[model samples]
Target: MNHRRVGRREVLAGLAGGGVAALAGCLGVGGSDTSPLADHPVAEGLADQPTQGPAVGDATATVVAFEDPSCVRCAAFHRDTVPRLRSELVDPGTVSYVLRPYPVVFEWGEAATRALWATYERDAAAFWGLLDHYFTDQDAFSSGNVLDLTEAWLTAETSVDAAAVREAAAADGFPAPVQRNLDVGEAADVTGTPTVFLFRDGEYRTSASGSVSYEFVTSALEL
Candidate 1:
């Protein structure tokens, strides 16, 4: 993996190229390394967030999706590509989906933590429901309102009364699993949101970023 410094301009522009190539060349890794996905290992110590659908599968492919809730691209990917995969790939028992939170954007980390917390507190279905809420109201939770809105969403979802999330965010202690995600992303050379890794038979086969199409992911999994 390349650790070369990426320019502030490229980082700010959100260039959708840099990391591993999984599908359609859209996946973005964090660093400048050009290594293939087969050479990399999933990052270590990512927080244990509630995840859905590492569904029972015949072929048994596990995908670790690195996402930040505040990223519009992530939302778009879920809205477009994920639904297709859920129906055709995941539901049929061909894939196991593991969602890992990456806190590239500060606000996103807060949202990710709260969202995962809600999922853990509630259930997988409720997690997606709350996620849908966030996606529908993406603009409502900005940096200024990150903690407040995240807490509100969690409260509504889990009906929990604890103020720990808000307090943590205020003290910059929220996004409980941020360091783990950061470590994993750094190790995997993940640079941006929506980066995905497809592991088959315990071997890394491919990776992708951005709004990858269902057809593309389907093809990659075939390898």
Candidate 2:
């Protein structure tokens, strides 16, 4: 990876400031064949980090996305790009898609991430739905309301126990898997939401920061 390695102090400072802003140029663009992928690395040991995030497809080529639930740019990617990625890359088995919650953009992000992991533990399939829900309704959440909002959403849209999810979200500290996600992001030098890393046949290929188009991903994988 060509990413810069920062000391723990730098990482903490970055996190304290909510990291870097999303690349404005990369946001709100639909998938276009003209878009280009950046030459970035997935960082050593990042591929092996434990994650409770949901995934799809079974291809050897994988696209791992590190995102914050409350990030508007990440929401744009989820709303506009993810469906095409699923249809053309993931559903077709050309690439596996994984989402790791980084929760760096907003104060409530960690709570929302905890709720997501709770949903994943109860029903893996429901995890994706809940994630989409959070992204789709980002304006409705806050640090004070994230857990309650998640609880209500889970009750209405899934079979998982809502109270349990709320409890998990309201817990005192980070869950082990969620902490691992933070570690992975820190190790990868992730500075913004919607950072994506690509791997082909278990070998790191490239990465892109901010919203990435399906075309960019396919071009990177040489598809």
Best by TM-score: 2
Candidate 1: stretches off by over 4 Å? 1-10, 13-40, 43-49, 55-59, 106-115, 118-125, 174-176
Quote each prediction's TM-score.
0.72, 0.78
Q: Which prediction has the highest lDDT against the true structure?
A: 2
Q: Ten residues in a row with the worst lDDT in model 1?
A: 1-10
Give the Cα error of residue 172 in candidate 1, in Å.
1.7
**C-alpha RMSD of each candidate structure in angstroms:** 5.9, 6.6
Give a tens-digit lDDT track for model 2, residues 62-121: 777887788777898888788888877677667777777777666688788888888888
Once fitted onto the true fold, the runs of candidate 2 whose alpha carbons sit more than 4 angstroms away are 1-23, 26-58
Compared with the true structure, all predictions reach lDDT values of 0.60, 0.70
Query: What clash count goes with each model?
Result: 10, 1
